[model samples]
Target: MSDAPEDLDAWVVTLADTLGLGADEHPIGLLLDLTRDAAHGVTRPAGPLTTYLVGLAVAQGMTVEDAAARTRATIAEWKTEPSEPA
Candidate 1:
């Protein structure tokens, strides 16, 4: 119920069970890292969006680990590229 770090594991498990998702299919640490990377390297909004896309990719048969890896790679590439003016 609380957004505390200590509550994350239980929250993830409960949410996963509620959505009929398997924990094995969604690694929390990897997803969190990807979110952080996307948010910092790309855009703040990209954090949740990237995570959502990763979930969609997994739902479409991609492994979570692979999705995370691909997402991280893309974020890395984005970081290397110059940003366009707002």
Candidate 2:
């Protein structure tokens, strides 16, 4: 259940089509960047969770760019905390 396809691009296209969304319409680059940052700054699991929450925000009217910026900002700040950070 946790495995990734050898070809991520193909998998994205397949999933998007299955969900009736255009794969090209999504800001895949931005999302990937956010995922990478969250995984590194927070935790491995946070990467997908962060994207899932972002997806919710998008579904609820927030633009993907704004959501990503907000999440990235959170990751940056969270990494800079004086206390033990994730």
What CA root-mean-square deviation does each model show from the true structure? 3.2, 4.3
Q: Which residue window of length 10 is worst by lDDT in model 2?
A: 1-10
Candidate 1, overall lDDT?
0.86
Task: Please report, as a residue range, the 10-residue window in candidate 1 with the lowest summed lDDT.
Answer: 20-29
Cα miss at 3, model 2 (Å)? 13
Let me know the TM-score candidate 2 reaches against the reference structure: 0.77
**Best of the candidates, TM-score:** 1
Clash count for candidate 1 is 0
TM-score of 1: 0.80
Q: Tell me how many residue pairs clash in candidate 2.
A: 0
State each model's CA lDDT, in order: 0.86, 0.84
Estimate, for each residue in 1-86, the C-alpha lDDT of model 1 and write its tens digit.
58886699888888999988766444778888888999999989999999999989988999888998898888888889955667
